[model samples]
Target: MSIRPATSLSMAQPTMEGAGVHLHRAFGFHEPRRFDPFLLFDDFRNDDPAAYANGFPWHPHRGIETITYVLSGEVSHSDSLGNTGTLGAGDVQWMTAGSGIMHQEMPKGNAQGQMHGFQLWANLPASLKMTEPRYQDVSSGDIPTVVDDDGTSVRVIIGDFWGKTGPVDGIAAEPLYLDVSVPAGLRKRLKVDTYRNTFAYVFAGAGRFTDASAPRGVLLEKEVAGQELNIRDLSGNQTLVQFGSGDEIEVQAGPDGIRFLLVAGAPIEEPVAWHGPIVMNTPAELQQAFDDLRNNRFVKSAH
Candidate 1:
């Protein structure tokens, strides 16, 4: 079993979105090809109600899919297609804005005004870009969570993990999205498809990932996982770890344990022309999407 080293690693940058809602952007709106078949990943975590209550007003999205996973609090959403719902804590909503759809999301914090969640955007292939729009609203109870013998729990959100399949389906990327949490000081080896592009995002706690060739014990914080190890090493939060060509990954949880999202997908390899929520293979196609939106002919009838 070969282990691949991590490539691009960076701390989540502070960015505000959705009408002044404060959040952290892990990666997005730049060089979409580096993470092909994937577009944006935003970590919307805040303890202040005023920072998130305004929420995202009505916005148009086309040629892509948006996955909203609520770690805490609730989000009430409605779309132009008349679909509406509320995502409570641990709930997940996968919306395929195939052609186009105007949507609005309003987040409500808990009694203490703590709101935390994540939203990831994935791109659709050219063939399916103009398909009918659809929604997959999976409640927390509907998702499959598996616990290992070592007390590591994995919640399958959008793809296959640990012999279980997520409730959301019909994705163009054929990606595997997993929320994993490990107990303190436990070393775990997880298998992944060798052909897919893989990356892990540390959301809570810190851990050590083996396979990088940058020398051992030279712990890296805020960027790579190795630079200088210390007792005060809580630097993995919001850090992205991209792996090289490997079929399995090894991770050793820190004393405080570790929790993260491991995502992988088969690259589309096609050219990407992105403009906001719209993505196309060529500039002409990108312009066509805008034209369709301006003419009110984006969403097509499925029947």
Candidate 2:
């Protein structure tokens, strides 16, 4: 029953991606080793149609899983396998680009031209890197949301929490993805697997994730209650809060409350050979993937 201490904390960066879509990049395309079994996380939020209308054109992915969760607006997607669908508010699509797949996502803003969503990339292990591609699309209605008596709530997206399992499964990472919300001035603790590498991304509201030593965690020192802390709120966003080896995390929400995603997974610990969007175990395997793509034989027949 030991509580883990906060090892390091840093905020995400404000970067532009996907044909001029302005968003915050939590981590990606640089030093991917810090977080094993996880590759990239993009916070694509916009309030203008012109900022996200162009969207992400067709792109290829292999040896990985891309999870897209939509908070508001809609994202219509199409893939090379002839699968197409529209993800509305609160929906999530987990696409496993095992062998290989080409897909496109175009975001259509709502009545106010406001769109918000998140996409997280998780790497597939060498064994399942070339498996057949598949999709797990979970609608908002199907996702279970549990509210506690203290006004704290959690929407289980993957793995298990609050005695509920997320709809997305069969993943190699065996990860736990949770959307947690704690009411103003409330303290909450969640249990995590001791062997898993866990971190939390605060996207809405504000909160302090602290250990027994640093009970106050961090304070932006200036923002009013309920407003989104900007990048300058270094004490708030961008800081990656890494925890020690423990099985539970304690967090206390600010006056305005807090909402964030808590994710954890067992480290692969194998060599990572990544280029562009493809991740393999070795350089030779990476070259082979490119060769297969050039020869038009990226996908193996489902047996």
lDDT digits (tens) for residues 134-193 of candidate 1? 999999999999999889999998788888999988888888999999898888888889
- Model 2: ten consecutive residues of lowest lDDT: 230-239
Model 1's TM-score against the true structure: 0.93
Cα displacement (Å) at residue 211, model 2: 1.8
Superposed by TM-score, candidate 2 places the C-alpha of residue 251 at a distance from the truth, in angstroms, of 0.7
Give the runs in model 2 whose Cα sits over 4 Å from its true position. 220-233, 237-239
Q: Rate residue 158 of model 2 by lDDT.
A: 93
Alpha-carbon deviation at 192 in model 1, angstroms:
1.0
